[model samples]
Target: MTDNSVVYDDNIMITMRGVSDSVGLPYTVNPLELVDREALVELREGPAGSAGPDGDPAWPWQWRGDVADFSALRALNLTTADARAAWRVATENKIYYWTGLEFIAFDQAFGRTGKPGPANVLSGTAVTGVSGSAASARITGTSPGQNLELTLPRGVSGDVGDPGGPGRIQDAADVLIDDDHSLAQDYILAWDATRGKFVPAPSPRRGGPWAIAKNQFSGGTNLNEPKVLAAITIPGQPTRWRPQVTGQVRVNAANGNGYGTRCDVEVRIGGPTGELVGYGFGYDIQNWDWVLIGPRFDFPPTPTTDFGVVQPNQTITLYVIAKRVKGSASFTVDTTGAQLIVYAEPIR
Candidate 1:
């Protein structure tokens, strides 16, 4: 027996021998596969409406097929008969086209007919049952049978209020009289009748009279004796003032016993109860011959610190204290030509 088998070549092209494939092997050939069979059938059948069996009109292609331009549209046989048929089946204000599968209808009224219209103007004269100028119109009455008016209402004036109470006025006799002699010399206090107060009288220059106090002491003195040489009483209560003090003492060797001696002098500001507020002392005054021992000292040495704020009614005293530090012989402090002075002035 022979090997009855069919062989397919790598690049074989099988052509159909007839419309039906039912014959012996050498008389017919069958293809293994067909590429684009549907497209091939459509192309072979031609477009719809071209013709049918026995030359009758096929289904009329109502819509133009995927028209590219006016030339393609004009190519369709759009006779009166075809146009009338298309108009009956087509939608108004809409166009149709085929997208390979089905027809897609685009509504021409989508944006045009669906949009809103322009606003209307309001007419004042058209308003019913109301009356006013056409330029400024309002509703007539709020309810039935009521008429509206246009006049503005005026408000009535109120009565005058009662008179206010009288005020107090001062005269020259009503002012107090002050006869204080201590009132500074070049200054005077005058009464202001209108303001009911005492104001200082105006002067050509500033400041009042100067207040000065001084004391001097001259007498014989002994050794090792503390004596209050000069004293002054400050009048004001807790005032700032300046005090100056000077002490002069002559030392003599008794019986020609030439010996050395030291003398001390102290200046102090004391309160009413003798409490020392401020004090300064100077010592070591040597004497071999008859010598004068004295020095002037200022309390609070600098002008910046010169003002000594004293207690109420204080007394400032300058005292002399002497001692024979080295010699066994005694010495006498003679004040025959010696003097102790204390002076004070108010800072103001």
Candidate 2:
């Protein structure tokens, strides 16, 4: 009919004569199917007052005038019985209303009689809001035309919302990828099949876990062959890596009196060696003693240029090679001098 939107038939309710979009010649209307919820709600909010036969709870009665008391009202000399029946509110919050020359009883609740709050001061003083340079803010207005302005400093912030309970997100993936697989940072967060969660993974674009070799290397291999100075195991086989190596190589003389003339070092990923890093040959390698490959780690040693692609299950290794010149040709490397800290930034 004209009342309700057409919906599926729950059952054949009490039918009436009406044409529907579905039915052609035959007219049928269900009482439940034609229920007008909006019309019902409108009827519920229709004009209501205490004067009506239906006694509405809240009645908007206007206080036409006010008098001091019932004694003062009697002193008005209304002159006739009908004139005495007019409505008048007293200072004691009592009402004087009448119907058909019959006086009505008093009810304090019919009008506002108490303070607005637990301790609200009922004053007619107007308030104004103005911005200030104070460190903290104070409100002048809460709602528009409320005459109160929420005065705040220049950088202060304010938000108006109903107070509610806190909400939460359980998964980090919800924040990073908004619960979508397309936006997941595969290199930074890897899927751990065992735990079934995203775990921090090694990526060539970010810093990986440190692979340190703190064990002392006593009387390292001869300067002729590359000595395995420090070896570190880098987990997660990232595609590419730029390893940062920190440590010093001491080329010890074979006879304790003989030192190497020069020293060199390189990094090897898996099995293959990458580029070699070297410092200039100083006096320690030739006349006086064994060569020290680097300055103290406090000073920046040669940065590793090795961007080797790591294979699966392969560990990153650091190798050192030293060249001999004057004193003794057989100078060996001693790694016990400094602590080696190595880490590889992967590019997966």
Best by lDDT: 2
| Decoy 2 TM-score against native | 0.34
Give the candidate number with the greatest TM-score. Answer: 2
- Name the lDDT value of residue 225 in candidate 2: 51
Report the Cα lDDT for residue 181, model 2.
Answer: 31
Model 2 global lDDT (CA atoms, 0 to 1) = 0.47
What would the per-residue lDDT of candidate 1 be over residues 286-312, giving only the tens digit for each residue? 443323332333433444454343433
Give the count of colliding residue pairs in each prediction.
Answer: 0, 8
Candidate 2 lDDT over residue span 169-236, tens digit each: 33454333333533324445656677676555545354454544336443455455545555555565
* Alpha-carbon RMSD of each model: 29.2, 26.7
Q: What's the lDDT of the predicted structure labeled candidate 1?
A: 0.41
Clash tally for model 1: 0
At residue 68, candidate 2 shows an lDDT of 73
Model 1, runs deviating above 4 Å: 1-222, 225-239, 253-258, 271-308, 311-329
Taking all chains together, the TM-score of candidate 1 against the true structure is: 0.29
